[model samples]
Target: MLVRVLGSAAGGGFPQWNCNCPNCDGLRRGSIRATARTQSSIAVSANGVDWLLVNASPDVLTQLRAAPALQPARAIRDSGIAAVLLMDAQIDHVTGLLMLRERSTPLPLMATPEVLSDLSDGLPLTRVLSHYCGVAPLPLALDAPQAVPGLPGVTVLALPLPSKPPPYSPFRERPRRGDNIGLLLANPQTGRRLFYAPGLGEVSDAVLATMRGCDVVLVDGTFWTEDEMIRMGLSRKAAAEMGHLPQSGAGGMIAQLDRLPSGVRKVLIHINNTNPILRDDAPERAELTAHGIEVAFDGMEIAF
Candidate 1:
């Protein structure tokens, strides 16, 4: 199993434009010890040749350029992105599908029925793409594991996560079970498992079990504290309200991560720009390291 962290920052990305916040400003001026990051997304490959993108972030074009493996040079007009697995219907996660409209064949898109409905109705991305390379929607079952369409030997199980739908969704207030999900990927050849939930709000029993059984767990690290955005005056909603589990406070992400077995490789992704862990010299970074969790960076890769 080959896993790649293509981008690690949350929605607007680290050092997001239009906002001169400390982290963003300091990073731009080279006064901070942090690295620039794009919006959150990941790519996984069973054979290393045929890659499966976990989410098509708004920064997917830049991510694709950074990872040469995703642009295999078999022909002048070819791509190594075998299929796309959407975790939700959020703008950041699904907008990049437009950048992939140049593909020769209809792209295989797997997502929960709810997520597909949003793109088809609310966002109309699936409808617009009909004129382009088009999309072939596939099923992502919550009851059992389904084989990834383009990647052989790789299977993924959809676990219902505690999260809300995007604002554009008509059912935003009436959140459904399949509105949000995390993917548990298994490599049959290596018998390695990975739990990836970049938008987790709570660690349910099924999520806990998935983490325990997997060798690698890549999770949401959207906020450092529960009221991060509120404290920064960026938004009125707290982190929890936005479907993210903050890293600090009682029963927070760190506390949950601490309970995992030492053998499991734990890593954090989808970090918000306001999170202090992005600063290399920050105490928060040290704290996570001490607890055996890695802060994912763009291009970070793990092979098992």
Candidate 2:
């Protein structure tokens, strides 16, 4: 199994435009030991030729340009994308689907029923393009093992995650239907398994059990603390409120890390620019390394 880190930043990306915060300012001035990353996305390949994109960020073109291996020998219209596995219906995660519209055939996209319904109803990319190929929405049953279309010997298991509180409805108990997911990929051919959760707010007992015996686990690392955005005055929201929990402080990533076995390799992805750990020289970065966790960066590749 070959796992490629396409982009590691959260929604707006590192050094996001329009605002000149210290991290952005330092990044622009080359004073801080920070790295520039795009929105969260990843690609996995069975033979390194036929690749499966985990999520299509808006920067898909740029990511493809960076990794020339992703382009098919044939024209962009004939490229071999086995399928696109959408984790959720967030805008940043699905905007890149537009690029597929330029292709000759309709793209096969796998997702939960709720996510599929949201896109089919609210954001219809099929209607946007004149040559817009339709999206073949495949249903993904939570925790049930299934095979990815066109990719034999590989299996994908959807791990349903808890959603954020209902914003519009005060009486709602669970979050909106289309909001959260995690993925577990198993390749019997390679005898490897990978667990990923980019938008997870909390790691459940079921998820922890599923993560066991995997070769690699790429978990969410959106915020370093619950009060991060509050301290920065960026928003009135807390990390937990946005369907992501912090990586540090009490009941956070570090605490959860202690539960995993030592053999399982771990990495944190979808990190925000406000995260001090972005800097290689930062103490936070050192701490993660000490605990055997890698902070993902764009262009990083891990092969098993």
Candidate 3:
């Protein structure tokens, strides 16, 4: 299994255009020891030739351009990307489908029916893309390992996680089963596994069981604390309210990660701009390092 961390920041990339918070301002002014990042997205490959994108982030163009492996080679219009698997229907996660409108062939999109419906009805990317390069929807069922159509040797297992609907969804009464999910990519050939959950609301016993004995685990690092945005004056909603579990505190992701096998490589992705972990000199960075957790960066590669 080969995994590439294309973009590691949360919805608004680090140094978000409209805000000048401490971390953003510090990075912009070269005072903070942190690199600028785009929105979160990742690409996985089994044979290193055909790739599957986990999420088509709004910054997909920039992310793809940075990864030379994803570029076209022999054919003028050929793309290495075989398909896209969406975890949710958020604008930041799916808007990049528009940038792929110029593809020579229709792109294969895999997601839950709920996510596909949100795109078709509310955001209408599915309907609008029909006029351009069309999209073929591959329904993802929870806990079922399905082989990616074009990419062999790779199998993806999705597990539903507790999450809220995207704010733009017309049916935002409450989240149903398929609103969001975690992906477990396994390589049957090598027996290696990777677990990814960038929109985790809570860590259930099932989620922990899924992580057991996994080679690598990349999880949500959206906020450092429940009141991170509130303390930063960025938003009124707590981290849990926004469908993200904080990285710190007693009932946080760190505690859960600590319970994973020591051999499991733990990484943190989808970090928010307000999180102080972006700073290299922050004490939080050292704390995570001490716990053997890596903070993901753009263009990071992990092979198992």
Candidate 4:
């Protein structure tokens, strides 16, 4: 399996345009030991030729430009991207579909039924894309492993997660089982597994079982503490309220990750710009490193 960490920042990205928080200010001035990151997204390839994008962030155009492997080949308009799998209906995750409208052929998009319905009704990306390069919605079933279309050696399992719907959704009662999900990619050829969950509200028993014995696990690192956004004066909602589990505290992702097998390579992704771990010299970064956890950066590649 070949995995590429295309972007690692949360929705607004690091050094978000409107804010001048300490991390953003330091990044803008080059005063901090942190790298500029786009919104969270990743690309996976089983054969190194045809690739499947995990989530298409708003920065997909720039992200694609940075990854040479995803560029066109011999044909002038040929793209290496075979399909795109959406985890949720968030603007940051699906807006990039507009950028892909210029493709010569229609694109295959996979998402849970709830996410697809939300896009069909409220956001209408599915309706709009039908005019350009059409979007073929492939509905994903929770806990059911399905072959990723056009990618022969790869199989993806969508594990239901506890997360709220995007704020823009027309039906905003509360999140159900399939509103958000995590992906488990398995390569039967190499006996390697990779568990990726960039949006997590809680670590349920199903999530733990899915992550066990995986070669690599990339989980959410959105906030360092439950009250991070509150303390930073960024937002009034707690991390859990925003559908993210913090990395600190007793009932946090860090403690959950600690329980995983030691052989599993653990990584953190989808980090918020306000999180102190973005700073290279921050004590939080040191603590994560001490626990054998890697903080993902844009353009980082791992092959196993």
Per-prediction TM-score to the true structure, in the order listed: 0.98, 0.93, 0.98, 0.98
The TM-score obtained by model 2 is: 0.93
Q: Give lDDT tens digits, candidate 2, residues 1-304.
A: 7778999998888888764777878999999998899989999887777778888999888888888778777753556577898888777788899977776666888887767656665675535643577776788787689888887665888877887422332323545544568888877777788888988898788878877768888999999999988999998999998888788988798778768899989999999888888888999899998999999999999886
lDDT of 1 at 92: 89
Which tens-of-lDDT digit does each residue in 1-304 have in candidate 4?
Answer: 7999999999999889887989999999999999999999999998888899989999999999999898758596878899999999988899998999997778999999999998898899999999999988899988888998898887899988877788888767766778899998888888889999999889888788878868899999999999998998889999999889999999798899998989999999999999999999999999999888999999999886
- TM-score, cand. 1: 0.98
lDDT of 3 at 141: 89
User: Local error of candidate 1 at 267, Å?
Assistant: 0.3
Task: Evaluate model 1: give its lDDT.
Answer: 0.91
Error of 4 at 93 (Å): 0.7
- Predicted structure 3: lDDT: 0.91
Error of model 1, residue 47, in angstroms: 1.1
Candidate 1 lDDT over 186-220, as tens digits, reads: 87877888989999999987788779988999999
| TM-score: the better of candidates 2 and 3 | 3
Clashing pairs in 2: none
| Model 3 CA deviation exceeding 4 Å by range | none
Query: Higher TM-score: candidate 1 or 2?
Result: 1
lDDT, candidate 2, equals: 0.81
After superposition, which runs of candidate 1 have C-alpha atoms over 4 Å from their true positions?
A: none
- Candidate 2 weakest ten by summed lDDT: 165-174
